[model samples]
Structure formats: C-alpha cells, structure tokens
Target: MTHTTASTTAFAPITRAACIGGGVIGGGWIARFLLAGIDVKVFDPHPDAQRIVGEVLANAERAYGLLTSVPLPPRGRLTFCATLEEAVRDAEWVQESVPERLDLKQRVLGEIDATCPAQALIGSSTSGLLPSELQTTLTHPERLFVAHPYNPVYLLPLVEIVGGRATAPATIARAKAVLDAIGMKGVVIAREIEAFVGDRLLEALWREALWLIKDDICDVETLDDVIRYSFGLRWAQMGLFQTYRIAGGEAGMRHFLAQFGPCLQWPWTKLTDVVDLDDALVEKIGAQSDEQAAGLSIRELERIRDENLVGILQALKTGHGDRGWGAGKLLGDFEARLAAQVAPAPALDITAPLELVETRVSPAWVDYNGHMTEHRYLQVFGDTTDALLRLIGVDIAYVQAGHSYYTVETHLRHLDEGKLGEELRSTCQIIAVDDKRLHVFYRLFAGPERREIATAEQMMLHVDTKAGRASPSPEPVMARLRPIALAHARLEPPAGAGGIPARRKETAAA
Candidate 1:
C-alpha cells in the first residue's frame, strides 16, 4: 500500500451508512462511523443482534471518550434491518463484513449491486480476499473494493484501500475522503494485491513467531514483551526501511538493505510451508493465551490495548507534526481555552470557583441559523451551574455519597448569536444559597471582545446521588461558596450590557 499526497478536494458528507454484519468487527465499524456522527443501519441474521451490537457500541463509546482528545460529534442514529437489501437501501456507504468465504462475499456483493444506488461505494472488510474475486459476480464491479481495517477497528487508525481492475480512481478518492473525515489514516494500494500491506508484514513476523514457539525459544508472553519493549517503540515512529536506515547510521537504505539481504536466505523463518491448525496446536495456543492474560476480562484487555495504542500514536503525532495519522494532535491544536480574569481576595481562595473545564460546541448544538442553537445556551449554563456546585462541595463524589443537586427550573435569555469558531466564556454568581435549594445566575460572554452573549437564571436542589433524594449542601462546601456568592450578590447586575435581553409577549387588547 502507498500513501497518496493529501488532496484538497472534499467529498460529499456521508450522512447515512450500512453495515452487512453485526458481529464483532461489524459492530465496531458501526460504533466508529456513528460516533463520528454518521447514521448507520445494520443487517445481521443472528437472534441476539441488537443485544450483542449494543454491548459492542457501549464499549466503543467508553473507549472513544478515553482515547479521543476532542469530544466526539453527536452519535448517528443506529438501526437494525432484517435483510441486507433493506440495510443498504438508503446508505451512502455499504460496509460488508459477512464471513470470509468467497462464495458468501460474491452472494452479498451481488445483492448489494442489485439493491443499492450506482454511485454508492461497497467496502469489503476481508483481510486478504482479492477485490477482483469478491466483485466477480457483481454487475457494477467497479463500485466494490476492499477497505480492509484491522481487528478491533474502533481503536486502530490504519485502513488499507485496495482497488481491483474495474475499480475507478474516483471511487478510491471518495473512499479516502470518507475515511479522512472520520479521523482514520487511509493508504491506497496502487494495484489490488494479496493480503494488503499490514497483513503481509504480520505474516512475516508470524512465521518467525511460530518457528520460535515450535523450537521452544521463547514463550508467548516473553515474545510479546520483546516486541512491545523494543521494536514496537521504533515501529510506532518509523517503518521497517526507515528504522533500518537510521540503524545504518548515515549509510541510508542502500547500506541497510545490503547488510540485511544476506539474512533472507538463512533459516530464520518458515514462511514457505502451511501451518497445521490441529486440535493439539489449538489447545496449546489457547492455554498459553489464557495464562498470558490471566485474571483479565476481555474488556480490561481491550482498554489496555487501546490506551497503549493511543499513547504511542499520540506521541508519534506530537513528534512528527502533521505527517498524517494526527487525529488527536489536530484536535488538540484546535482547542482554545478561556480563563477567569478575576483574582481571589486576600481573605478567600477563588481557585475552587474559577477552575476551567474545556468543552466544545458540538455540531448538534448548532441551530438552523448556522449558530450555536438556543437550547444549548441553557445547556452550557447548566454545566456552569454544575461547575459551581462542584466548587461548593456538590460534586460527583459528594453526590455519590447520598447527596446531589437537581435543576428545578431555568430561565434563559439569548442576547447574541454564537457561531462556529466563536470562543465562549462563562461566569456563575450565587444569588442565594440556603439549606435546601440554591439560586444562581450565569453570564455567558463571547471571546476577546467580552461581549455578553447570554444570561441564565437557574434554581438547583441538593440531592443524594445514591438514594435519588434531596439533601443539603455539605457544610464545608457551603462555607467556601458563601463568601464568593455573597461577594457577587453585592455587585450591581449589568443592564442590557451583555448583548440584548429577552422580550416578553404583550397581552391581547380588550
């Protein structure tokens, strides 16, 4: 697979997608696409498709929250269909994850060809199946190609796109656009080839790994450790050729290749012969895997794997700049921060009240006016209230210990429209704090101009997070909040100074 120069042209947004299988891989594909804000429809014949897919989605969401630096766009709607035809009927992209059998792929491709629109792209998730073989029976074979992604597709960033003879260059370009928008790195294969790039590399390593295990050179855990602690680190930043080039110390690729070429003929690997998947071998591998991953559930193992991948990828991204594969880095680059201007008084500490939490206006928050929508104003204000609550000892830890706060009601007056790229700052004032409920007023300001954007008045009731009941604010937290709230309360309220105030409707005349 070869990496193409980054293209400036953007493809049409992928609003709707379809998945042909609801197994692990298919479910992961669904989660990734949906979390990137594309609506998805899934088709699978299994009886527990919904339950299984839902579980996978839940795990994917958790992983996404931890791995991604930026908050994900609103999740797309997910639908389960009874048939493959129904699933792809309205989809812009059809992700085929049916079993690895060629006959089954041929059948599914034929069905997709008959049902989906001519312009839609069909992406096969087959690890090694040639695109030509998969599209042999389809009427529009050019629309079908391999978009092979690694297992646990949600975490891995690499997606190899291989085009068959009939596949159009435009189709590959469009597929690359879709992958790029969803924050995945895509490499195009110049021509369709067996096993693609990553798999071929893995196959070479696998042959050697098998030889080691067969000859009792090392156990599974030790072998994994050797790679994780050494080559894995180097590979994260540079590929095989580049790594060796550096090792040659200014001699470059030519010298490295000359030195390593002699080792190719040595009996270092058993790639020429097929390995048997006999019962004994299977049992041995399974037992070794169990021993290696002892006491860890699948979810725990997956989290560890994803975290490691994120850390390594993020480091590479930071070190290499925008050399592609910089999704998290790009997000971090786009982040803007707003800090409170006011300082703490000599007698009191203001750090608790003014600590900033970073958040972005999600695409879903934009209204028809192409600006941050109205309801979102109230939502951000609510978040401000939560921040205040936390400062005043009404935080999650407090709530979980049988104390919490609920928003009784809110009144919002939007003064100005906030659009994309507009940075928002918020300040909260405690109008009143008592035994049962607290009254707070919030001011939302826009950017460096400090223009008033909106104002919100909210009433909150303390409650128990565990018992689902109301309680008083903790005494210590209340003591800390009292001074700040009282100080703000004494200041005069600004009049129509932010942007504009909400207007009231007039009564009908008699």
Candidate 2:
C-alpha cells in the first residue's frame, strides 16, 4: 500500500496530527482529523493502505455532506510518511491504530516516544488494551492516553477518553478539548480499564447474539431484523436507562424495576459462558453472514450503514430541548460551534435582501428526481419568515407572551433546482407593512455563484393567542419591523411583486 502525501508544510499547532496505522480504525481516525481541518501524517506499511483510507475518507465525506448544513472548513492535507518517526515528527496529537499485539504496540510506542516532540500527545486506538499497559514503554507516560472511537469515526461522535495511572489529568482534559474541537464527544472514563464502557456493553449483547445464532434459535438475518427493527432504534436515541424509564410508563423507573427486575434472576442468558468458535460454528456464522449481506461488498454495506446513521442522526438533531438527543445533541453542539465561528450576521442588512438563513440541501430534502423536494423550498422560506420575526423580537419568549406572527398566505415561485448537498441561502425583502399585516418577498440562492433557486411572496398577521384573532403588533415589536419595512420599501420591488407568479415562471422545483 503506497500513499500519495500532500506537500509538507507547517500545520496549526494542535491541528498538526498523525496516525500510525491505516487499517479500518486508523483510516477512520485519519478521516475524522482531515475532515476537521487537521493535517494528518499516516504511516502504514500495508500495500493497500492508501486504497483503504481513501475508501473510508470517501464514505466520510459523503456522510458529512448529508449530516449537517453548517459549512466545514477546507480539508487538511494528508501526508503518508515513509516511517513512523517521520509521521510523528511534527504531530502534536498522535494516534496509534496498529493491530492489537502487546509486543508490536510496545515497540511502536517506544519508537514514537524517542523521536516525537516531548510536548506531543500520544493516543492509543486500542479497543481492549489497558492504557496503563500501553504506557509501560513510554518515557513520558503522562501524555499517553486511550482514545477509543467507534467505526466510521467521522459519523459517530463518541470517543472514549481514558487516562492510565501514569497519564496526567491535564492530558485527559487537553485530549477532551481537542476531541470536542474535532466534533467528538470525549467521555472520560473514571478509571483506566480494558474495553472501557461502550465496547463492554456491546460485547455482552454480541455474546448473546452469537449464542442465539449458534444455538439455531435464529438465523443471522432474523437476529438482525429483531435488533434493527425494534430496540436497536430505541437504544440509539434514549439509550438504556431512559428507555426503561419510559417503559415504566407513568409510574417511572422504580415501578419498571419492580415489574421487570425479577427477569434478571431468570435463566435468561449465558452471560458468563464463552462460545467455542470451532470450525462448524465458524462456518455456520460465515455462511449466514454472507447470506445476510446479499451480494453487497464490504464497501457497499459500509455505505448503507452510513446512510442509516446519517438519517438517525439527522432525526435526532431535531430532538430534545433546542439541541438534540444523545449523540445527536453532540452533533447539534458541533454545528452550533461551527455557526458561532462564522462572523455574526451583520446588523440586519436591509440595504440588500436581508440574508437570514444559510443551509445545505440535506439528504432528507432530496427527492427521487435528484432535486430538492418542493415542500423543502417552502420549509426554507418559512424559516426566513421566522428569522424575520425573530429579528423584530418575536422570539420564543415573545411568543410565550401570547403574541406572534402567523403566516396568512404564501406564494412561492420555483426558478431552478437544488441538488443534494447544494449550498443554500435565503434573502428576505419586506414588501409592505401595516399595524396588523406585513408582506415579504424572499429569494433562495444556491452555491457560490449565488444562482437563484426559488422565491417566496408571503403575508403574515400578528395575533393575540388568547384572543385567537389578528391584532396590532405591540409598539415595541412594530418599532423594529417598521424600520426594516420602510428601508426595504425604498428599494425596487421584486418582479410580479403583488400577485400570483406568472405560469411561465413556475416549475416543479418549489
């Protein structure tokens, strides 16, 4: 495995990163770093190292495109170093994803410690290795920590951060801060243990799953169907404790335990029993797995997995409070950070169409025709209306006060297509405003060329929620809207401003 390294150059301090292996986990680490705009130096002697990492990176890029609307920073350079020493030379953060062998890991860490800068942090990507054992050979063991990430690292946000006895508290804190910057939720393990947290739970369930298969109680497909079709979905969002708490219904967890706790004592599982992976069992599992995959290649299955994860994540991004649920909440925080980094929306530029919303056409917004679906166009335009209302102080608190703007009518005109992942922005120009009625026109633009995609003409009425009827805006609210409306009135009006869009200007897009 040969790799094509980008030209060598100075990298931003902490963002200068390195990976010592290029197999699945290593490649995933590489993808996550590069996508986070961190330069990565990967050293892997495997002849197909480049091919493997490239495939993973391709999938990661696709997943990211579907995952969020916030624009990502430019990709960092990938350098395939000739040696481990060369890879870690300038890396402030080094991740070792070599195969899980004690002697090999010790040798590699010994080599990395001797040559890498003293300030550099070393992370072991071992799923089951004790961080303490890995740190045995390191001269500066304080910097050696465990950073265990799930497969398809770019999509999944959790990374278990474990510090060995020799590892410094500051190292764990620094590692977590770095992980947070790269969009990972760094969960600190209280103690250094083998197969920390996530994998241990997964192993228990996996053991049961294998027993079910080996005992002929269910086929691989049936077992998968049972999981992916039911509790698996529940597990993704609410997770174990919360799901059980919900299962308890109105009585809650104490009641749930009273009802189902006794099942724990039943002869329910072979939790302590180890199943033999003898030839017959191995062949049986392999054949069943092959059938379960149909004709899809490993790469194909990875894509399917990514798509499902992205869909679940996107759904969760819309969950819990103003953020999301579980990993989805982490995702929401990440995007929120991305939004924060951008220059704050310049003081409501009424001089131009008020650029209110910027987003990308996510996968869910696409249709079979390979364009953004019609309703999504309306969704974007509605978002623009909401933004306008908020700018005039019709915020959540304001709405909670029994007052808000309600859209009475809307006229949308589709002018062009919005393909999946296309960059999108909306500009709103107020057309007219009175004590009770406000009319606005919005144009949706796609991509850097600022090509027009669609337009929306809308009228909204301020109402008293308690009275449930149109009402004059409070003076404070009108004070803000009136200034923008007056300024926009001075500008030339949009084409066919006051009426229905002409038939020729319409299309199936919006």
Candidate 3:
C-alpha cells in the first residue's frame, strides 16, 4: 500500500499523513493532503470504504481544479490499509474522523495514542466532543488535539484547532503550520469549549431553523432560500456584526447597537425555545427537502453546489464590479502564493506559433447562451498577450524600469462557442516587430478536438509608463523577442492577421 508521487516538498514529517477513518470527512482529508503533495495512508474497515473514498476524491478534484488558479503540487499517493496501526506506523500526523460516539472515540483515541509514534500529532475531527474528554485516556495526551474541518474539507479553508489541558502549546503551533502549508486557515481556540466557536454558532442557527420548521413558520426550501439569497451572501464576506454595522448607516457599530440591539430582547427569534424532533416534524422536514431536491441524485446536487461555489469564489478573485470585498482579498492572496510557486513554461516549437496560455472555461465564464461570454474572450486574449510578454523577459521588473508594451488596438473574431469546462489554449505568432511597436496574431482553440474558438490581432506599442508615451523597447527585451520573431517568421502567416477596416475585393472584370 505504498507508492510515491512526482511532487513533494523536503519538509520532513509533514510529508506523510494518516487518516484513520475514510468517510466523507476522512476522505476529504485524504484528498486535501494528497492534493498538497503529502502521501496519505487511510484505514477504514467499511466494505465499500475504498469505493466511497474514490468517489469523494473525484468530486474533490473536480471542485478544486476550478477553485483556484494556483499551481498545486502533484497529487500524493493514497493507500488504504487494513488497520489503524498500519496507517499511522510511520506517519507524522494522524487525523481521526470516526463516528461521533463518545465511547468509540475514546477507545480509538487511546488506541492511536498507544500505536502512533510518540512525537506524532493526533487530530480528532470531532464536531462537538470536547478535546479534554477525547485526550483523557491517552498516555501521551500532549500531542492529541482537535482539528475540526468543515464539510467538503478540500475546498473550505477553515479548520478549528482546539487543544485540551493536556495538549502542549508547541503541538498546536506545529498543527497550524502544517495546516497552513496545505492552504488552510487554522483558528486556534484559546480554551477547550464544547462545539468550539464555529460549531457553537452553527448549532444555534440550526436550532432556530428547526424551531421555525416545527412551528410551520417556513419550510426547508424557503428557510434556505432566505439565507442564501440574502444574508448568506452577506455572511460570506462580512459576518453578522459587520453587516449590521453597515446597516446602521455612516454612524457605525455603536449606532447599530443602539438602533437594533433591543430587538434581541423581543420574540423575534425562537432561540429561547427548543423543538421536539417528533416523527411528524421530522417527516415534514424530510418531505420538503426531498421535494426541494426534485429527484436529483446526491452526486448531481453536489456537482451543482460545487459549480455555483466555484463561480462565486472565482468572481471574488477578480472582485468583479467591486463586489466580493473581503472574500476577494483572500482569493487574491491565495493566487499570489500560487503565482510564486508556478514555474514558467518550457521552450517548445521555435518555428511555429507559441502556445502561451491554457485554461478551462470556468462556471463564471458562461453566458445565457450556454457558452463563454464576449468579455471573457477578450480576457483570455489579454492573458495570452501577458503570457507572451512574460516569455520575452517583459515582467514586473521590466515594467518597474519604466518600459512596457501597451496594446493600442485589437481586432477579434469569434468563430465557435466555448462551453463550460472546455479546455482552451491561446497560441501567439509574431506578425511584425520594430523598436517601439509589436504586432501579434493569436488563435484560441478549445475542447479535445481543438476547434478554433476565436482569433485576435493585436497592436502593441512600447511605452515609458512614467513618461506616458511611446518609447523604444529595452535591449534585453529585444534580445529575447527578436529570436522568437525570427523563428516564427518561418511559419505560414496566420489567416485573418492585421485586418482592421474591411477591404472590398475587386469584382472580376465586369
């Protein structure tokens, strides 16, 4: 049950992880670790555990492949072991995602403590069980703590780290470091509290939601819509407090508290009361949820959800139309890390057009016509031009030196539609280049068949950005570009190159 991958960091210990349970959460942990280039050993005794893990991995790969433009490390190996001992034998970290029975959890925690290496950290993925209780039976309990993650653990960045009295401070610090390396935000709770912070707030909301359903105030769908279509969007970036502060006008939080804080005392919410999960109430909720799903399979619903999430998160990356303020900041930071790690494309065909950029049509790229929108085509062309500029030693440093290429004109022609998830590549051929001007033609091809989706002819002028006018290209840049232009000159000229104003063909000898 051991195989290696192509990409891995030299950071020892954290390179390998053991997941003791392979259900949804455990499989998610496996996927996350694997995607981060950490080899994973998983132990799950369920008969269909492998199948389930495979399915989760597929879904995770689909979602995450579109989640960020970050260049992820090559996927790590996934090994399913027969027992927990085999899984954690040489592992540096152990994540236990077993069911939420206290007795079972205690026994398993003790077993892991006895079996795993003494220095290895043990993280229990318990939603509500206190870390104190879980670590009680451990002989070396200092390494045992809670590292609870949200559902779809691979996509969501938050992990709640709660250390019990027996847990050492260094253990929490190391855990946070490992989690951060894997692109997760580990929020360290100061004390061991039942349910921790996120789950406590989530449980309160759940309780109120159930009470509303029980009282026939709203069905499941309506309640969900109310959150998602309104407050849920707000909560993604600004939490309840900040959102309310904005609602208070320019006066801010103090004014907000004065204006609406008294509403908390009113019977506006059912938080004070509890709802009985009787058969009738349960049936009503279940039936409504089922109806809301409209016979879509769980996998189908999951895909739909992942698509919507990816779209929103990617849009936030651009902060399009000034939306996605706070969440956009996180996306931008993640992309910066990705950009730092990404290696430049290697040298390829010198005698032909260089294929500079490749990307898939994301969910956001789609328009009402069921294909990529017009503006997105321009974005791809712009990105293609940027890629070529980078290849020719024109980058941040070059621009900072007050010299850069500014596109003055572009002629674009759309040929075919690009559907969602279609892989697209842009190829650029140098049409002409001089000291202060460069002209290139680009073709966008998409899908496995490589159908030409669009074409663009661009005219760029070298500019001294500080001077705000056209300028001669730097010698270093010309050194790089001249060879590429020479090599590309041998290829057949691209069709539709440099056509701007329409030219009428002469009628044959009328």
For each candidate in turn, the TM-score is 0.65, 0.74, 0.77
Error of 1 at 319 (Å): 2.4
> Model 1, residue 290: what's the lDDT?
93
**Which digits, one per residue and each the tens of the lDDT, describe model 3 over residues 394-451?**
7656776788899988999999999987888888988778778788899999998999
lDDT of each: 0.70, 0.82, 0.80
lDDT of 3 at 4: 14
Residue-level lDDT tens digits of model 1 in 70-152:
32344689999988888999889999998999999899889988999778999999989999998889899888889998767
Report RMSD (Å) for each prediction in the order shown: 16.6, 7.4, 6.6
Query: How many pairs of residues in model 1 come into backbone collision?
Result: 4
Per-residue lDDT of model 2, residues 216-326, tens digit only: 999999998998899999999888999999999999999999999999999989989989889999999999999888899998899899989989998887887656888
Query: For model 3, what is the C-alpha lDDT against the true structure?
Result: 0.80
**Top candidate (TM-score):** 3
**In model 1, where is the ten-residue run with the lowest total lDDT?**
1-10
Candidate order by lDDT, highest to lowest? 2, 3, 1
Model 1 alpha-carbon miss at residue 279, Å: 2.3
Per-residue error for 230 in candidate 2, Å, reads 4.0
Q: What would the C-alpha RMSD of candidate 3 be, to one decimal place?
A: 6.6
Model 2 scores a TM of 0.74
